[model samples]
Target: MKRPGPLFTLLAGVVLAGGIGITNLVTGTGVTPVAGAANAAGAPSATEAPRTEPPKTAPPKTSEAPKSDAPARADYAGRVEGGGASVAVSIRDGHAIAYVCDGKKVEAWLQGVTVGGKLDLKGPKDASLAGSYNTAAVTGSVTAGGRTWRFTAGPAKKPAGLYRAAPKVRGKASKAGWIVQADGSQVGILTTDDQSAAAPVLDPAARTATVEGALVVAEPISGVDGAGEF
Candidate 1:
């Protein structure tokens, strides 16, 4: 009998292995052949991964100023009753001032911000006044020293809006001032080279008066400057 060479024996072994792999595939044994089976060996493949997408991220949050549906008025003055406290508000070029005081005590020099059809004024000592108005009158409240009071004011008078005057006595210069109260009263002072006087009581219906034989008048303020001192 003739015997097969070593090379022939090796070829026969490979054929038998391939036949067994084919049989395993046809029988659905779930077994993969070792030849050309890099994935089955748990090795990384050159083909791209499943191509998964990244997760989505959310947008950032932002803070902005509040919007209003009310129209803007340049100058305003308001008052609250019962407390005898009053407010003078002025606005120009979007800047404003609110002065809350009794002209004697319990006063607050509040800053005014341009608020719609309404006025809001605050001060350095935690005093504040807020209200709404038209060309005729203003109504609002003032909060100062932990208390809040309500008032209504008008615009047809002096010391209620703006006042400015320069008097000359015997060619000497003097200064005078007056403010109208929400209670239909007047508060004023006169300053000369030597003295200053208290608020003069005047007829609520009059804008000019004679005090100590001195002619006094209260003028309307038409401008605002962030609660500029009286």
Candidate 2:
């Protein structure tokens, strides 16, 4: 047996190292790619941005609308179709009261319960009024003295509505009604027993009227008060 030279030993070592490398590759234990190895080392990669879920978004909000319904309390005044008469209506709760006058012999006081802004009122001598109302106005037709007329009445403010006066003048039964128009005009009628004539001027501030020679208190008619005594 002879000793191997340094060159021969070096050659043998090189061959052994090559064989071990091939065996590692075949056994699935070879060094990975630089990029893959770095990724596996738990370092964040430029190609893979930090996984961030899209910002959670909330749905848009909505506002609720107010409810629309018939008014619980209201007063309206207007003229008839031909302007031959003035009409006034007052409503409180579900009850309604109305008055129509020509400032002459044609006059009526009507009352009834309102249903869903609809009015169907009846008065003396077959007088009747039918209509529908809203927050703005009332539209309806009235029948009296064998005649019918359509009318539209707008909202009436204070000092402009229906007024009534009942007092005994010269010991006789007497009654008066006034309709203060929205345009500052007015019309009314006074009745004593079977006679009818023009009504006296009514002072809204004082709520009074002078009848013949006597000063009488004028009551504002309202559906709340039922206007029953009228």
Candidate 3:
């Protein structure tokens, strides 16, 4: 049939467009992008934010320790029966102080640190004492004032221990206090109104020293009451 030219052209355009649309629908050839999907093996998706975890950390250290207490310190004093001498020792914290004397022939004072049941003491006049110690007994020899005595000491009884000299110099405002120990040695300092000085050497047998031109006579007094009696 002969038709108008513009009308026939419009109908042909509609039919062609409809046929293409129906072909796409029937063949299922159209594709649309998904909202969210996995990307490459390790890459993140466009619509999703990346996820992360916090860093790992170690545990805190503790301040307290087990079995922290150390060994106990002690004091010991005794007499040497063979030599008729006396001894005394005091132990504190990690330090030790000891004295030995016969109230006549020997006297000394020992000081040192206690470690591994051992003691080494140093005193005035280049004196020294080396020995081992335990709670029940302290067996050691003290070398002082050019003499040495091997002694085993325990608890002290009355009238047997340490002694200090009771001697004063005339005209000096300061008196001398000496450790007239049992191992036949003495350590002291002399003080005067003007100044102080190391004590002069003394004759232990006489208990006298020529301090500042005066014959300083000192009586031995017991560290323990009545100790220097013999």
Candidate 4:
């Protein structure tokens, strides 16, 4: 029934406020630290280093290599005759052919004879004449009729020899023998008696001997005969 004093009203207000505060704490209803909200505020918070992909790597570059080349070859053919002897020959791809004559004059009369080996003039002994026919341009010494004769082929321009027979006193005079040319000069008769002593000759000036009834035909070598491969 009586009016309350100011001090009393003030004390009542204070008590009411304190009671509300205590109730709020007990209920756990006030603002609290959120699990990820701190970082949202632009504060430096525990964060994974910016996941960055390694700078993109470049592929390695490759280089090209150079190619190799092949060797060169020769080209030509030739023949030789002397001391009732004859040889048919040809040259191709560093190979040679020499046809041996059974009889001295028989080789000269045949068209051409081709041998079955290489021709090389630079070898020790006659084996040098085994491969290729480059000897068409070589000069050397030869033995014929028990004498040594110098010979050259290709461009030395020297006569090799001469052939003659005795006048026929009875029947037709048979082919007699050869007159050899030696050391830039002409020499003696090449008889069967001296045939064994004769050596192969290379005369550049000697006329290309003709095979009486023969013909020379050239055959291509296998592999190199056609357009060569790469």
Q: What C-alpha lDDT do the candidate models reach, one value each?
A: 0.59, 0.86, 0.59, 0.33
- TM of each candidate vs. truth: 0.43, 0.68, 0.40, 0.25
| Residue 130's lDDT in candidate 1 | 79
Q: Write the per-residue lDDT of candidate 3 for residues 37-129, one digit (tens) a residue.
A: 446455687766878888888888877755423234554555544665556666656676666554443456667787777778887777676
In terms of lDDT, model 3 sits at 0.59
Best by the TM-score measure = 2
Q: In lDDT terms, how accurate is model 4?
A: 0.33
Report the lDDT of model 3 for residue 101. Answer: 51
Q: Model 1: per-residue lDDT, tens digit, 1-230?
A: 98999999999999999998899889989675575478777776678476578988888778787765333433445555765655666555444555555545454546665556566777766888777765666677878757788877565333356443456645677655545654555554555674555445544345565655677664545553222332
Query: Candidate 4: TM-score?
Result: 0.25
**Reference-based TM-score, model 1:** 0.43
* Local lDDT at 108 for model 3: 60
What lDDT does candidate 1 reach at residue 139? 71
TM-score of 3: 0.40
Which of the two candidates, 3 or 4, achieves a greater lDDT against the reference? 3
lDDT of 1: 0.59
What is candidate 4's lDDT per residue for 10-116, written digit by digit as tens?
99999999998898889988757787787788665686465568898789878776432211232221223343332222233433322223234222211111233
Model 3 is weakest, by summed lDDT over 10 consecutive residues, at 221-230
Deviation in Å, model 1, residue 61 alpha carbon: 33
Per-residue lDDT value at 79 in model 2: 94
Name the top lDDT candidate. 2
